[model samples]
Target chain A: MVAKIYRKCGDIDTKEMLFLPYLRYNQSMRETLLHYSFDDSSSSLSASGAWTLDEVERLRTLLEGYDKKLRTHSPETLYLDLSQVTRFDTAGLILLRDYIRDWQQRGITVELLGMSEKMRKLYVLIADAPQAKIVLRYENFLAEIGKATLRTLQDAYAYVQFLGELTVHLLRLLLKPWHLRLKESVYHMKQAGIGALPVIALTAFLTGMVIAYQGAVQLAKFGADIFIVDIVGISIVREMGPMLTAIVIAGRSGSSYTAEIGAMKLTEEISAMRTMGFDPFRFLVIPRIVALIVVLPLLIFFADMVGILGGMMAAKWELGISWHLFVQRLYEVLALKHYLLGLLKGPFFAFIIATVGAFRGFLVEEKTESIGLQTTASVVNAIFLVIALDALFSVIYTEWGL
Target chain B: MSRNVIEVENVVTRLGGRMIHEGVSLHVQEGEIYAILGASGSGKTVLLKEMIMLLQPLSGTIRILGDDLRTIGYKEASALRRSWGVLFQFGALFTSLTVAENIALPLKEFSDADATLRDEIVLSKLQMVGLKPEVASLYPSELSGGMIKRAALARALAMDPKLLFLDEPTSGLDPVGARRFDALIEKLRDTLGVTVVMITHDIETIRGIVDRMAILAEKRTVAEGSLQNVLQSKHAFVKAFFKDINV
Candidate 1:
């Protein structure tokens, strides 16, 4: 296939095989014709893209090919088919009309086999007197049952795949041994979970201080500056702790899972597991999930504590509140519900992070790009799901009076 | 100790549209080094992978040690895993583990041996592979390409299994190092009474020590037996290959 393309590109090395794939105008379209569709199955002698003038140049060039090739060889029916085209603007009009004239002058019976309505209308509009006389092969849009059926099947396939992967994820948690793969899984969780403690702690603490300072300044005018403690404590424990923990995990552990698995896949290390009579999930996935399940809640606990303490610093100085009252109000605001809520969401968040990370890794298609793509998608998708689910929980918990 | 006839009966593996290994099969006798040889994409590694149960065949069954891996559960599969050892192409030595710890993986796994005994065994395996006891403290990244291969071999030999598998045992090595490593494999195979199977594209490794050679080709690929039989194959692709090498 590549060799056949080299013939079209006029003996260029693979390096010179530059595809001006993102064409914007006629020169770009010509560049694409010169470099892009060299081995494409769909391209006839001519295919057009991006711009009308380029499309016309492409048509004129294709028309010239018949005259040039047939002048020496025997003549055959040449088609000015636009059936493959899906859209058209005005400039495609003048080029086609001039092309038709050029073909007639050369005594070639070049038939316009297929024209979209828009293309035909554009040509007719260009000829203004309404005598473009271009033939239009009308195609029924709804009658493309084949493509529609394929698309519907593809969508259904994607949906079924989602359900299948979901089931696999659940079964992996339920059925895989907690005793053995714990070490391997926890090994990663430590790097991703426990090891990230210092930074996450500091981040939460600084964030708490910042939020408290802002809250104290606002509350001071209202003679409620002391309330900054409640704000920081309640917010960090109930919402920020879980939210921040997940986001941190997504960035740290999630991307690590993706890159680790990506590199494993790249190196055939996953396949090595298969040869060794071990499921990759057993050796790699199960362990990571179990460890995170065990550790994420703990990290969230620490993050909450750190953030609340940072809040306390602001409560003491800016709010002119003593440490005792600040601690008291903090304790008052932090109900068991807040702590339970954050911890309850721990395993769920871990599950999402692990699944998204592993799924992205699984989604890699053996291209160099898949490494960055998988890692980026891992964090983005994990964070998105985390935020989306958090909103759902907020709605549910509020309605449930938690 | 036992002759494991790893029959890959009518195996077929496909990824999307391409048929990677079509109806590939091979048999290895006890105390024999069955070398699977091919270029990078010729599915040699895939064929060897089946021996370890890494790849699933779309069709056919793989019988290792009189058990079908596909029929077994995870625990059962893992249980049977100790019977064979695999040396990955890049050594796949746990970068986190030192040379001794890496080699001790299988021994620590299959045996209920004490730590001191395991450490002693690790030392012995390293010695057999011509590594000094002091080198055991170094991690995989610290080792040279040749040392990594040896450490991986030591790990594979840790269990003293009935069968051992190595992928590209001498790849990325200097010629002298490659030769020395090949000699170590030869020496270990003789003394250990272990069935050895290797995936290699190294012609010199094949010539020097491979007992039987599986030349992975197209549909007619994976012809295995004595090295002489493969060298004299009449298949056009096989014939032209040997002709190029002037074998």
Candidate 2:
């Protein structure tokens, strides 16, 4: 029957190469092609040519078709003759092994024949090994939502724990200031505080000018252009200056903190510190937090000064309000409480940024990509917490009638 | 009767104003496991890097698979690169991708084979390197030192290249694991018919499976050949290196 199929094609010399019903030679030049002759009545199959990596797809399709046909026919036994296989590799062998396993599962006795010594060794090595299932993880929408919510809660808990540890370490260092890494603190101040000066000044200056211009437009309609000083002074001193400086520091230094600590963690430097009897929190976290705490208030103060200067300039240009009159109005109306209130939020914002950044750094896994991921999370979390804390401060201050 | 798969001649390399390899030369024949041996600062790695075209020698010629490394075009160079595989010392598996994806990456990029076929090839290569199929979904960071080496080897063999380059393949493994690694390399060479070129300091690996070797010392090839042929040299480094191993 197999020979008759080839004879019908009439492309090859089937009579010369054909041996029997179960042994028909496939005279083709493609070394990777697999040809099989199946004797339907006896359930005997003879396959020839190459069974290698290149023939994986074809071999799979052929074996799958045979699997379906075998299921329909319900053959008691399947004899697979591979004696004429010209080439073989692990790819081909694995596919054959899997189909054979499937056939056995379907109550068909599969017998492998004409196994070479090399093939037998390969068979024992690969076939006898314990197979592990490939698990691709998938979750429905609700499960994903639950996992995300849990992750967020876990993150919040971890952050609180990190803050508690930081406070303990801070108190310990406060008792012995000599144990504090003063040099590292100074270095971080230079990086996060001094290095951030120019950008903060520029952003705050522009923000003050925009506010002055917008407020002048509205006040000029009411012929109360002098009130622009009140709007710019109160907003920049009490809200804009501190919040903008914190957001900028969150993006710049907070990201750097996470990346630096995360890289150190990935390289096992954090572990090395612990093994060497150095408290990583006191050594790494405290220096950054102290630096930001000391510097952020100063940064906000400087931003307030630059922002008031910008408001003076915009007021003079847009509303013809003299710089002297603006200063007089600022001194009178923008009370010391407003300036102190803005400065007061500085330490809280700094603590949030530094702690969130360093805590995320500790969460980095061993992979380099984890550094990038944690750094991004650090910046985002710092900014979010900074804004939320500012809102809380506003609510508390308003309730207290500050 | 095997042809020369790699041939280096009178190579000179200078890095950072220091003469690393004044004049070095070596050849690796097809179907043989060749070892490049030297001390820490002897420029053995520099020579290997030069052979693989990562670093060019100041003056010399390296003919790999009959193509001159110095003057080869970009198209020809990439084509030649696809015909061989390289395994770095630290496994260098992409941290972002899983072990299976790392192994299947080259197949996906270089071949027209679909995802299913690529997955099968990945499993087959994993089995070839004696790894459990379950390890396929694991990341490089999750693997132990030995498993990382095995996974990296599987990835290197993904394209079924004619040549395999290994850098300190058994450097970090325990004695038993190192011996198993050497056996696996030997078996792979026999089954896959690939020429193996490796840089190693392991005396056991040098004695166990190396068909031929070249000892690099003091900026040149001090000795080159089979164990008997290399032992014939009276070089001080050669004698000291093999003194403890009684092969």
Candidate 3:
């Protein structure tokens, strides 16, 4: 509906039309009653209108113009006349309060004059009400550093406690294998291990091919191209196969674990299980951890085979080394100790991924957003810990003169 | 008597081969507090959603505020939407934004008010819904069940809508809170002249606030009138519904 600005000109009604369809003004037939006149000598402004939401736009514009004038004139006192306001709503009350506040902030004393009883009550309700205060305290650089240090220490403490509980649960399950849900463990095995096989094989194969191609380029310069087989075999069996498989699983199965259990946490399903006399760790965490531990070694062995096959194919293609010759050279240089070293890290990697994923899941609160946050944290923490553990193992093996 | 603000005629809706609503028709007048009541699986929410245009009826016409929803263009449909507000069952406040920002969203998007004016409107809307200005800074997750409902109500009223739609406004609230909410709705209707369409099964709300009601049964609106009229309905399901509520 169109907004009509009404002006009362000496007992004659005049209306000015303006298009404001959103206003939906229904009481346009009310007497034309809005007029604001300024008295420069007394520094006073008088308004007469309905002053409701329908006229808020025009009112704001008028008030803004008056405020600018007052700022230039440097008025010490401003009087507001609102007795002629025929109607008022929350919007009108807020506008009046804002104007009073704006003038008061500029060292002008605002005084209300000739307000009706209803207007007086409304003014008191809005203007006299205490304004809400928001206090912001700034922290110094040292305080920020101290806060970061304390948070890190607290997180470390929580991690240790989580590890302690997991160890206890694992030991208890070992003492009673009959209590384990074999069906559930197999289900998780298929998900975490079998479902991840294609990606793991693809990553390991590509890494092996890249290593062989790069090694061939450097070795051919020194007439040492035949040693490409040894480089591919030793690296795949000792490091690349296990590390790549673990990283892939951490991205895939670790995130799924966090999301699933985190959703259950949100629905209070884990609490329900505990209330039913079930150990949540044994029911939820132990099965997942056991399944990954059992399947990861086999997955790493498969990755090693695929990686070797990829290297052999690249070797034959790049250096004219036949598959038979490549196999023979691989056997001569790749020792059982190197292969065993990679296989041995499988359970450790699996333990870290499963525990970290479940730990993050259990950390989820009762909010839907927590599921997404914990899932992201699960993948990132698992991948970082896996790499850190791999570096630790490399340092230990190098110091042992292997 | 006022003109009808909502007129749904012979609406038929199906979901997954199940007929949720069949030939259901109802109308709500202006400045009315109309309630839609139904038992479980009786399509109360489905009908509400259809009226809001979230879901389309298979065959029907919904006329809201003189606009036939089926034939309206996107601009016209949005303009019509701006004339009304909806409150979902769970107070579906955006979790990422604080209370004040959520209330300011419609104003910021639709109106060209400055930041200071927007802030004043937000505070006034909060106060209109009986919420303190301090509650504006808190996130939805930090609010209690009742506080969330109030905050959602404040957001719904931000645009000064002529029609307000509420879905189970008192479902999760305590009895005292629910009564206070019903009183607040009644007060808003009286003060703002807003027409309200609510879907609920709360007997207290039906008795205290609703001016008229529709009972969905037998895949249609079997009864539509004042609470007393619906309670006096001869239909078996309507009788059982009110009897089940001990009303």
Best by lDDT: 2
> Compared with the true structure, what per-residue lDDT tens digits does model 3 show for residues B1-247?
7799999999999999999989999999999999998888999999999888899999998899989878989999888888788999989998877898898898888765666666777877777688888888888889999999999999998877889999999999999999999999997887667899999989899989999999999899999999777878889988787775544
Per-residue lDDT of model 2, residues A68-168, tens digit only = 65665677777888888887766578678877777888787888889887677666655754344455566999999999999999999998898888889
Best by DockQ: 2
Provide TM-scores for the models.
0.43, 0.86, 0.86
User: If you score just chain A, what TM-score does every candidate get?
Assistant: 0.60, 0.82, 0.80
lDDT tens per residue, model 3, A355-387 = 889888888876658788889988998999999
Q: Which stretches of candidate 2 lie over 4 Å from their true place?
A: A1-133
For model 2, which pairs clash?
none
* Candidate 3 backbone collisions, by pair: none
Q: Which ten residues in a row have the lowest lDDT in candidate 1 chain A?
A: A35-44
Q: What TM-score does prediction 3 earn?
A: 0.86
Candidate 3: list runs displaced more than 4 Å: A1-35, A39-59, A70-93, A100-149, B244-247
- Give a tens-digit lDDT track for model 1, residues B1-247: 4465576677788867788877777777778888877666888777777668877878878888778867978887887787677888888888766787887776565554446445655666676677777777777768888888888887876665668888888889999999998888876766555678888878788888988877777853546777688877787666765664554
Score candidate 2 by TM-score against the native: 0.86
Which residue pairs show backbone clashes in model 1? A26-A54, A185-A287, A185-A288, A274-B53, A274-B54, A275-B52, A275-B53, A275-B54
Docking quality level of the chain pair in candidate 3? acceptable
Q: Which 10-residue window in model 2 chain B sums to the lowest lDDT?
A: B111-120
Q: Per-prediction DockQ, in order?
A: 0.01, 0.34, 0.24
